[model samples]
Target: MAGTSDPLTPRAKLAVTAGKAVAAASRAAGRGSGSVIGGRVALKLDPDLLARLAQNLDVTLVSATNGKTTTTRLIAEALKAAGPVVSNALGANMPAGITSALAGGSESKFGVIEVDEKYLAGVARDTDPKCIALLNLSRDQLDRAAETRMLAENWREGLAGTKAVIVANCDDPLVVWAASSSPNVIWVAAGQMWKDDAWSCPSCGGVMQRPGDDWFCGECGFRRPTPSWVLSGDHVLDPHGSAWPIHLQLPGRANKANAASSAAVAAVFGVPPQVALERMYQVQAVAGRYDVVQFQERDLRLLLAKNPAGWLETFSLIDPPPTPVILSVNARGADGTDTSWLWDVDYTRLTGHPIFVLGDRKLDLAVRLEVANQHFQVCDSLDQAVQMCPPGRIEVIANYTAFQDLRRRVGN
Candidate 1:
């Protein structure tokens, strides 16, 4: 549906009509399902419709394996701080999602959407964003995504002739390679935390050099550009109380990269470094991913892991895993119907045996956890899992659908 049409205006009109009908039906059903994109079924929509919807608005498109939501939110916040802005806050990153987000703010000056890596090119070709933020690529959703190299190819093809201000994470070779052909681009290196797992130099097939904190290719002398703003030192603090001064309101090593990437993009909008840094300190965490909740006398942490990279990063941050945890796995359409990506996650990091495992695929997760040498108490319902979970230091790992189900059950 995305590439078939000639003019986007007619397709957009049709999409709006369809969306309104669905929204009304969902409302009548007493469900908020209408806010979500691609929640019903995996029918591809025309990109022309998305292009027509973004015709008048200045658009900022963000794509990454991880941290796109946080980075998108921060970019939107920074832009809104300067003036009025519109965004799809629902975390829908597809063509229909782009349309849905635009449906909310028909008169806003700018539009920001966190796009999925696979659909980014179609969305870009359709939306024609004025600015594009290319973040790092990691192993995520391997089953659905094929592999990282394939995702990179999709990204490259989708972004051609975007005519947008390309803001890229220079440390990521794939991101850099994607932006190399772009006419106007600004490279933002993640000063201290830049990590590369590339096997050989794309340019010369030589080994890479890790000098100090940054990395460089040995043969071609290719290296990441110096950051526009470096978030160095040990103190990287986020909104949460500072255990580590370099506090990322989000958890894991990937989040620090996300924060730094957001700051780099914010600099493009003339947000002073200090002001942006201060704002980062005050920004609230996004829901479903490292969102901390309080229940009566219990402290609950909800981390979303729809893909392998996300799960691994979340696993890494949750160091010295909490005792008696809850792992929720689901295969609902919204949470990715295929749950095979579980093979990529390192469940071993969750050393302590979970007290409860919940989901449509609870046993599947239980088996995975068991293979990682952890024991689990499997439950069919989320409520049962929460009821069985102890009060202090409780953690929940959920996919998108399970999170929604768990939130509804727990009254969050």
Candidate 2:
């Protein structure tokens, strides 16, 4: 027999190296490992790290274009409602970030992780989660993801063989179609989540129909059952206003969808609906993604607008502009390196006079806003933008790269 070498010995070295590398690069980049920003060095590690880490724990992986971070955090909290658990709740949804998170809590029994769409297959194959949540597919990170259709196809291919208890959002047609093809699937829907951005039929190119509050393939008449756990009006005590004594502590229609999905998935694992709702209500915002901050006497709400889907959702929350919005756009290689994705975002909905556009690429943001015939004041620096804005109610839309810049400059 070969001499016994400690199996954990090699992993210990890898873990130390991974942690040091993540910490060093993040420090150099003026960010932290668990923050909404992705670490520069975490992507350098092999994708198998998360899979290796998952071998030691019972894990649940959540993936989607939007509502992922919230859903991931919600599920983790829901599970925690039943008992103690560990999670990678920093909004770092890729394989490496999940690795870093799991490595940080190597001793925990349940590891709930949020994963990006692109890395779903790789992480799923490696980690083999006990449960998985596939939220809706939407136009997100167009430059990086190319398109939502491509993401849907990738997800279908990736999740074909996974033995996870799949919790899927059935409201989105694409998600419903994908989940229908999968075995052992549970559906979660957001009834009347948003009617304005209704998707057209993929096959016939006709307007998709919503009959009896349930979406269907308009052309083909491929009617699917309404989700078992639809968000009823009664379930949502407050859709827009915050803190109305609902099941979930968070507000926003989008947050309701996220909470619904998390509740559905938790219920699949024997967590009672009442218990899940109670735990979800205890959940709060994760850092700057939707974190409300009081800085320089201004009540600022920070939201991540990495792609069109996120921007659209954020748009629905705040009142029509002239609210002195702070729009930040930055160009870095890691943050898609190209600002072309900005065009995909619907800039028409946002109408404001002299909006404060700041960051490394403030001029680009200004130009984009100007083309839309919206008033935007270009700032030489983020500090100037902060100085220009008054306290009490400011909305800041920061892209992936812009968020890092904002944190350093605005103390948000």
Best prediction by lDDT: 2
RMSD of each: 5.7, 5.3
Q: lDDT of all the models against the reference?
A: 0.67, 0.69
Q: How accurate is candidate 1 locally (lDDT)?
A: 0.67
Could you tell me which 10 consecutive residues in candidate 2 have the lowest summed lDDT? 236-245
Q: What tens-digit string does per-residue lDDT give for candidate 1 at 164-214?
A: 888887777767667766777776655323243354554456776766666
Q: Model 2: what TM-score?
A: 0.82
Reference-based TM-score of each model? 0.81, 0.82
Candidate 2: residue 186 lDDT (0-100)? 73
Error of 1 at 331 (Å): 3.4
